[model samples]
Target: MRRYGQAVLMLLVGAAVLRISLFSALYLRYVQSGLRPYLIASGALLVLLGVAAGVRAAREVPDEDETQDPHEHGHTHTTGPRLAWLLALPAAALLLFPPPALGSYSADREDAQRAAQGIGTFPPLPSGDPVDLSVAAFTSRAVYDSDRSLKGRTVRLTGFVTHGDDGTWYITRLLVSCCAADATTSKVEVRGADAPATDTWVTATGIWHPKGRLGSSAAWPPLLDAKAVRRVEEPSNPYEQR
Candidate 1:
């Protein structure tokens, strides 16, 4: 088994990647959806490499009558470090019990790093009473849009619930530029509606409650006067693509 450690490690890693990107949508929790094809290809390559390595190792066996060490003939045999097999533990975990997507804990770790986009006029929204918008879009318009496109219009936003230290609760979603490692938080302060459990997915319909000057600190985390809140299943792709 030790002789085939490298092959086993490769197979474990390949299977883990395939389990998330090819067999399920779990890859969305870590990477952008558009990268799925690359992941699948890489996984397939790894599996093939593992199989090839196993075959080569099997064929390198010495004859029973030839007990000379290969090193005595100016040849040194090399294999992966024994400790390297520990790396397979994480791969096995990923294959068996993929972790959930980033939620409130990840959201809380981010502050107002996204406020640098100065205030500007945004395009008019489509004609409708209640417009469905992504959490990132709503946050952008509410915080920086000079036109106040969301004012007086009932808008719907979906995200998990996150609580502030001061009893404030927000409907929050993470925005990823490439993958979860670069994820940023977007949220709206919910008013007039009780906050559900933390990490609970919900769709909230409300009117924009302008708090302060556009692009100011006070305008951050723009408030929404929610009229209705409904529990919903978590989305397959939890992070919003920026």
Candidate 2:
């Protein structure tokens, strides 16, 4: 049993990743949904390998006498570096604490110079009052469409709060082309309503602020003059797919 302790630890960690990725939503925080199957497959394989190593270690008989072709008992049966066992600690952290989609914590750390996605001439807003929009779609229209595509239009935007330096806050969401690693901010400076705590999810109904100069490619998304602000639950899939 002692001989296979490290192998058992590996098996537990691999099982953890597989369990969380399959049974929980945190997997969406680290990677895209399309990659879920691959993670499950890979985790399963690692677990099987660990089990095999444990079985092999248990089957090996210790040399009874040091003089009878003996070496250190632990080294003789254990074929892998002990240091490799430490990798399991970080892998297990995910299971210890639930990982939600990137929230205010991640958004605040993001570079202000990151470019907005979906930039270009925007099509006319589909006819309606209080049109629903993704953070990316709203940001592009607000930033690039100079004729005020969003002017006088009522809109609903859902996002977490990114506390800003100027005492205001950004209603923010990350736009991921493939995964969170490649995500960029698509935020709007929200005015009129009190800023919510960082990472707190909320739905805001608002009209666009029509005056700020759209900065360079790396500029922040345009501001929204919010009509209402209220707390809400985080969406099941939080990142905006670009």
Candidate 3:
């Protein structure tokens, strides 16, 4: 029973290594921020326990002249020594070069745009405080009906990317409720000299101008006179704050 347990534990470690290597993006999607540290700690503890059990099993052997044959002793041979190093390779890659958040690669994918989904009407902005409407909300309204409620009002939004198909540029942003797996792209297309470079974070202050269409996908409000377009670092939580 002990030998069987040790074999199962080793196989689990091997599987974990492969998951962290080829499917890191998938792993990141499911594991939330604080949960990651706990996973790492638990994994380390299991690995150490397995190692100890393996060492003990290696030291136990039947006497040569026992009543039963030595080969019949309750030990199962394992090829663990040959495969144990594979367990460390994934960790090494992450330590040396961590991957960037899923960005432009997903942006160009047709399924990434949320405008194709239904649009909703946003209430009027309050008199003093800046109104915070999601890129999804803004795009939905404009796509369904250009002359909806989001016109001629000053708005504030944050996102990455600052270019458009019509030679004009924008300060685009994405709203991600969870991880990158479910991220939906939405942008406040701004056209002006102060437009930042691609992928640069910017907080844009401008009025929504419902004029042009985003290819065949949907119509969006354009920024006529952007008051400010200052570049800022990407937020820790890259997804849209729900």
lDDT against the true structure, per candidate, is 0.90, 0.78, 0.57
Best by TM-score: 1
Once superposed on the true structure, which residue ranges of model 2 sit more than 4 Å away at CA?
1-6, 63-82, 114-119, 214-219
Off by over 4 Å in 1: 62-80
Least well predicted 10-residue stretch by lDDT in candidate 2: 65-74
In model 3, the Cα lDDT at residue 87 comes to 53
Q: Sorted on lDDT, highest at the top, how do the candidates line up? A: 1, 2, 3
Q: Order candidates by TM-score, high to low.
A: 1, 2, 3
- Which should have the higher lDDT, number 1 or number 3? 1
Clashing pairs in 2: none
Candidate 3 lDDT, tens digit per residue, 125-204? Answer: 56643455556555555565434665666667777764656766755555555556666566556755565677777777
Residue 227's lDDT within candidate 1 is: 92
Per-residue lDDT of 203-224 in model 1, one digit per residue for the tens? 9999999988788877888999
Clashes of each: 0, 0, 2
Task: Identify the leading candidate in terms of lDDT.
Answer: 1
